[model samples]
Target: MRRRKDKHHANHERWLVSYADFITLLFAFFVVMYATSKADQRKQAEAAAAINSAFQSLGLFQSATPTKQLQGATDAGSAPAATQDETVTPMNVVMGDQMLASPQVQEDFERIKRHLEGLLSNQIARHVVALRIGREGLIISLREAGFFDSGSAVPHPSSLATLGQIAEALRTTPYDIRIEGHTDNVPIHTDLFDSNWELSTARATHLARIFIVGHQFAPARLSASGYAEYHPTASNETADGRAQNRRVDIIVLPRVTTPASPAVHVPAAKPAAIAAAIPAPTATAEATARPLP
Candidate 1:
């Protein structure tokens, strides 16, 4: 026999060492996955908390409980007086009282005015309607003859489309809208209405209903008032003046008091003057008011 080397033979079970290493590596991978999953959950919870905090700061909505911070997060103060060195004044509160009292809001109102003017250009040019920057943010004055019949609270059929357009334009705005009905000093007595007060109130209520029910405007943002003969843009001494007095005013109010600007007064023209200036259209049944017979 050849001389056999006495060197130690390699172990046949050495594959067990490789198998143990693989098991360890598999265990480590599962452990890492579990750790990563826990980290993801924590991050999601923190993100939700940050969103709630932001909403709270903006006064958007109420939360059920106070939000908790992440494990290592430090509280950061974003409020103006957190350090007590910043001077907060009463003017700040006053300014905050109105959401629309800012210069930016005023510019927005101007743009709206221009838009309205363009929309009602024909009526505006014919002097049947007037637009003014009043003590209120904006005033759109609609002549009675153009919208209603004499002593009637009902709007003319032709006026519906125009009123609908007006509602569409204003329903989306943030400003509060007040629809005011006014009548001439001349007393009105009809089966439907007792006096100017009743007539004006009915007219205002009618318009409000259209805005709320027809156009789906927010009831909270809309209001109706009847001034009767008390609040007139002109003296009700002449027929033209009376016609001017008999009008509806759509007032867009600012949320806060704005700086006063010079007001432009719109004068009322005489009925005869109006008729003479503008060609009279053919009399339509819709134009006639059902007056007391």
Candidate 2:
């Protein structure tokens, strides 16, 4: 008889607990997916912008110096054709080749080539004599035998006029100049030059000193270094290539910043150095370190 009376049961909303958990997980999943998608978009944009900027900067880019010439001028070398456009591709630009042709730098390789043709003609033109002049400045190259003696970094008397001519031109140009000395695969051992490296450096310094003292180049802008058999424009396999490799190179670059204040040596080099040092981080740095960071 008691079974007929159904006890009043409490309404349990236990299903809401599971529903809330599922909703919470869904929200978190959506948040994570949104973050990942946003990050991917930003990264792709950044990469696209970088590629675009590099193309714009380099003179080789069609936009920088457009040429329908490349339209038909598929690479004769190992590089592939510009098969696609609108999408960025490595074929659009070659980093190594782009570096060689600096926008601010005018490779006088052509002008120097012409000059050599007029002067040394076929003899030197067949070799790797080069001239690189640009924002970094200018470098005129001559092979060891072309400008010096066997196993010697000393300049031949005949080459003095050539060097003098370069210095004279640069006197009014006002760009800082460095004479970099290079040598071939052969190791030079002599009393005057401890090794080929020293010989190359000394020769470069020798020319630099002359340019500064005689031609009135700012001493601050002049420097010299010798790289013996380290940097070669050509191969060392053949005698002709070796001759080309054993040479001097000049480098010129633009001044990105103002000349540093002349060092006033006091009892300590610290005060001036400290004054010249870059300012430390400010309050803005902490603000940048946030969840958004």
Candidate 3:
């Protein structure tokens, strides 16, 4: 057999790979540059107009007294009279009109905070109970160590008095109450609780029951949710952080005041008046949905 001649094939397509990669990189660079460019002026104006309209429609903006009156008050150095006219317009108005964004509601909220602070001074000093006024509303955080035992949903007997005090303070308010339960990232399995979800829900439900059954809070205004290590305020990698994450938060809904906004007139209604004005209770224990973990 004849010896096979060695054949050499010259490759011409080797450079295409590098060229394609370069084109892809160039396209990505231009895309990034375009994405970072300033937005169009017309678009910005439209966005601003839309936001203002939405706020107005939602009644989030309350117009204060005229500029002349404000100037007069400033010159006189005396507080101007409150402009909030407690005149509920037509009954067809939205329920948002009765929200806790008025001066009276703010006073009530402050009064509640002061009373609770005085009653739970020891717990507050021990860092077991923390009170904060956030945009959502007033938040009362109860640390697990001070409220519940490990793997247990029932709060300690010693903390019952504090809870009772809190209930009494809020008994007369018409704002809705939301009880939230959170846990650390550590996985827990017990006979009573199969997972953190069950544990957290049980804890929140038990606390809500205290308010509903023990304190006779209106079931319509009270609700509960279990976050189950999903809404931690601190890192779960450290001991102290985990401790901080595992807690219960009671959020009073519809902020009483927006310190960021100008002083404006917004009417408020008392609990009894609100109860009479508002329709029947719409919120129920069975209506609350359990979010997937």
Candidate 4:
């Protein structure tokens, strides 16, 4: 019995150990994957919250909670019915409502219009000037016949008095003034100008300078632009229409809403000083007025 070594018995249970280890590792791997998925979901929620807060701060989104709730409800397949009152108003609509509700702005516009009508009665009757309330606020149109000679940027000597009067009236108001120069389609090539664009711009700048230097208007409150052969109030096919097209428009812009501060009172310039500051009319400027064809 000693001479014959006992034959080693084959152990069938040894494979069970490796199978148990494999099952444990598989369970652990699933646990780790579940934890990672949960963490990613939490991060995504935090990122969404941060983005919503930023948009809310910018006033681009009214409420973020509603959006999230809507998304959640949609995902759950039970979205709440929207009510008519819950409809979101556009930003432009709200701004328009606020502007319309401003009674002070309307009152100021009406007062200015009435005062200008009274002051410019004579010129209005002669068709040398016109005043109207437009979408852009008050528009005071100065016909070319009353201000500048044909193809000339220099204003007539008589026009300076009228301009001074107008400037005096406007100085008390806080609104900004925009001077726009316009020209007819008739092509122009002159010593001082190459085309209608140059002519129109020169006319606008000249008037702006008169306002800033002669009338002592605040430079910040003034702007100038030129539209040549375009933005025509009347057609360029006839003499009268062409004349109307070749005019300068003074537009008074509405006041902006801001924190209340003491209104600055600029002293009015004397009539004599204003006249002196204006450039003297040239001989060409004094030439007989002729309608542009």
Which candidate should be chosen as best, given TM-score against the real structure? 4
RMSD of 3: 17.1
Model 3 lDDT tens row, 70-136: 2232567576444352221111111343433556556766777888899889999999899976555
> Candidate 2 — what's its lDDT?
0.54
Model 4 C-alpha lDDT per residue in residues 52-94, reported as the tens digit of each score: 5565333333231344532342467565554442222111111
TM-score of 1: 0.54
Q: Please report the candidate that would top lDDT against the real structure.
A: 4
Q: Which tens-of-lDDT digit does each residue in 1-293 have in candidate 2?
A: 56687799886998999999999999999999999999998777667656655654332232323322322336556563342312221112224433334343334334443454455444346553455443233456766766677765446656665665556555544344567787777876555555666767766766665565445565665667777777777798888788887787765433211234432322322223322332322323221111111
Q: Please give the RMSD of candidate 1 to the true structure.
A: 20.4
**Candidate 2 ranges with C-alpha deviation above 4 Å:** 1-23, 26-128, 132-138, 256-293
Model 1: per-residue Cα lDDT over 18-45, one tens digit each: 9999999999999999999999998889
* Lowest summed lDDT window (length 10), candidate 4: 88-97
Between candidates 2 and 3, the one scoring higher on lDDT is 3
Give candidates' CA RMSD values in order: 20.4, 18.4, 17.1, 15.7
- TM-score, every prediction: 0.54, 0.54, 0.56, 0.58
